[model samples]
Target chain A: MKYLNKSWIRKSSLFILSMILVSPLFAWAANAVDYSEPLENAAHQIGAIGEGYSLFSGIFPEYSLPGTNIVLDTAVAGFFGVLVTFGLAWSIGRIIKKGNE
Target chain B: MHIPDGYLDLWLCGIFYLLTLIVLSYSGYKARENLDEKKVPLIGVVAAAIFAAQMLNWPIPGGTSAHFVGGALAAILLGPYVGVLSMASVVTVQALMFGDGGILALGANIWNMALIDVFVGYLIFRLFKNKNKSIAAFLAGWIAITAASLFVGIQTGLSTIFKFQLQTTLLIMVIGHGVLGIIEGAITASAYRYLIDVRPDFFEKSNKKEVEA
Candidate 1:
């Protein structure tokens, strides 16, 4: 918990927070519809899955989480994405570093 | 922009996949040669930050939303090759976990966003850094994205399934991204300014290593 007070962590958190604040969860800005849906549908005729066949597809609606509250879902999803991204990059970096060493 | 499935034909997707593979292989080789243990955490943090920031979508006038694609910022902070890897991870995750993009079109998406965006941004930043770093950062963000958009326009326009003429798609993508790129540039410059102020040691070390190498 003490690590939370670190300057970098604090700064990073603020930046991430600012991003989430601007997201559709807050409705501060007009949410743009994905214009690709028509193209995706056209591709579907040729066996394309469009949005994707992933389990989480459409559940998050632009990568936000699913929950009773859309706002909380978006915030939680953003934070979760950050953690996952950090972990994935860190793991890859470590592997690359160790491979070189 | 995350391209969904069916946007590109399989043949084009395959070609882009091979291209992406070649670039990523070279980037991995470069990373192995140049990466430092001390910088590993920074890569993770930068990737994470980029991923988070990408979720913030800014509305464009015509009801289309544009989000910050942070490849330029990543390249500035972590060098070009490492920046590609960071962005690759972010794009890969977005496709795989979130299904934000089509699995079949993933290769093309990566080629456009991760490879083109990062390298162009890095080259632009390096080209003009001595003139004015902040402006250089801004231009890097602006031009790199526009360049990437050119490719997206080409890809979608060339595909038979897309239904838009090549000229029309090209104009729309380039012009739209060119305008949205200003916002991107401002954000990149601001973030670069903030990071440099807070983490001068990181840039100093990165620059010193670049000079020595």
Candidate 2:
């Protein structure tokens, strides 16, 4: 029992220490992936829209029905996103139930 | 929200991963305490179900797709500790089998989605427990998922900001997750409601313990 307990403690401590050492490297890699330049330009252009200035105007801003803004698009997107998630959850539930039976 | 490879600061991801591991370990202990040996199969089946469900992608409004992260639902059914463990299992399997999320990102993903959504969501549900089960479930599931998604979004935005443009990345993340949040909320609500009808036994067990207490 003593040996087992000591081994467990050593394993746990090692796991903790390794996590501490490895986490920073992951964060640095994440920081490197930020797409700032293009996003900044996009935000700037979007901010300029109310000033009667146009960028990417010829692309037909209304992809769907007329007068639908980004908010509406987001709402629409969210609605479907929820549906998909629910379907997945339910299907998983069904499978689990089946497997158990 | 499924965090990609480069979404969070490495340090933040590491911290989250450690935190998740701690929570998961604790939760696993608690689950072992509460459940009998016979329950293991049921839990395994449930975990598998959640794992498979999480992989199914549905299209969102902006031509993007999102999947289920079943933290809230698990908590609602199995209690918070068990819920978190179940979520951890699902996430671990996904990372290993499907490569849905990054290995390093697993910690953050589980913390943001599983720990937050399950525990926080269950707390909220308990708050509204006196009113109605279905309503409480809906509210809990909806709020929990939205909150988790937002947390993920903010983390993503911050990571992006650390490297690139702060404001733009924040804006994109917020907008993307805001939409994602609504979807998460709706799906959580629907699923919770469905389970309430089908598996009242699971929900009832918690209620019985409370009443017995």
Candidate 3:
């Protein structure tokens, strides 16, 4: 009973108040995303999974290769994007370690 | 979020590239000075994870969607320099392989996403972490992306080639990233909490931790 004091109560109240204030910031600014096409395409072919919502497309617009092989192109780019980045960083880290030694 | 090519003038491009080079070199130096074999693999895995995560998009409250930019998460987990290095790696790969960002603007993207996000996220989280880990993470993610967006807006405004308005660019960039930052923060806090619980060793043995201490 003695442990529950005024300062503790104030702190708890403030935390709750702050949380209430923050929730609306998220609520106010949301926009609608068109998921209809993605949903429709995903139903037709397994390749559709590699369509509009690709890992690389949003960041790199040039990645939007408009061809019959769009799926293959995007997939290859996405996988290689990870591989090349990993390889480059790993090599740099390795070099620095060796230099210090 | 990747600015395509032809947006920046040659001089602006050079300046951004130079800054990125300096930071990249410095980070590499710091990482090497206390080289650990495990950290190399760790860096690779984190970079790859970030690149993969960037692919997935989450819808915002509005009609738009935003994806994760793992800069802050990397900074909090690995410390700022390593975080920058990790992000730089991701940006570089996207430019060269996917043509995701413009080659000229690539440096600027790295500056914004990697440099600014990592440092801001690390600093903000460190500042408020004593209060609550989740809140700190949220602020880190939110502010880091907002700050990165500001930098991009400035770069676009600065370019003599582009007729972009600074205020409008800044507004759109900030608002968009501000929303996205929340997602980034939640992802960071959850992922980080999981990591700290399961793989605390990664932090304990990190070169940045050793140096900072």
**Who wins the lDDT comparison?**
1
TM-score of 2: 0.61
Best by TM-score: 1
RMSD of each: 4.2, 16.3, 12.6
If the candidates were sorted by their TM-score against the true structure, best first, what order would they fall in? 1, 3, 2
Tens digit of lDDT per residue, candidate 2, span B66-112? 55666767777677766676676666554543344556678887887
Where in model 1 is the C-alpha error above 4 Å? A1-5, A21-28, A31-61, A64-67, B208-213
Model 3: per-residue lDDT, tens digit, B105-174? 7888899989999989888988887899778887888888889988977886676655556675566667
**Per-model TM-score on C-alpha atoms:** 0.87, 0.61, 0.75
Q: In model 1, which residue pairs have backbone atoms overlapping below 3 Å?
A: none
**Candidate with better DockQ, 1 vs 3:** 1
Provide the lDDT at A14 for model 2.
54
Question: What is candidate 1's local distance difference test score?
Answer: 0.78
Sort order, DockQ high to low? 1, 3, 2
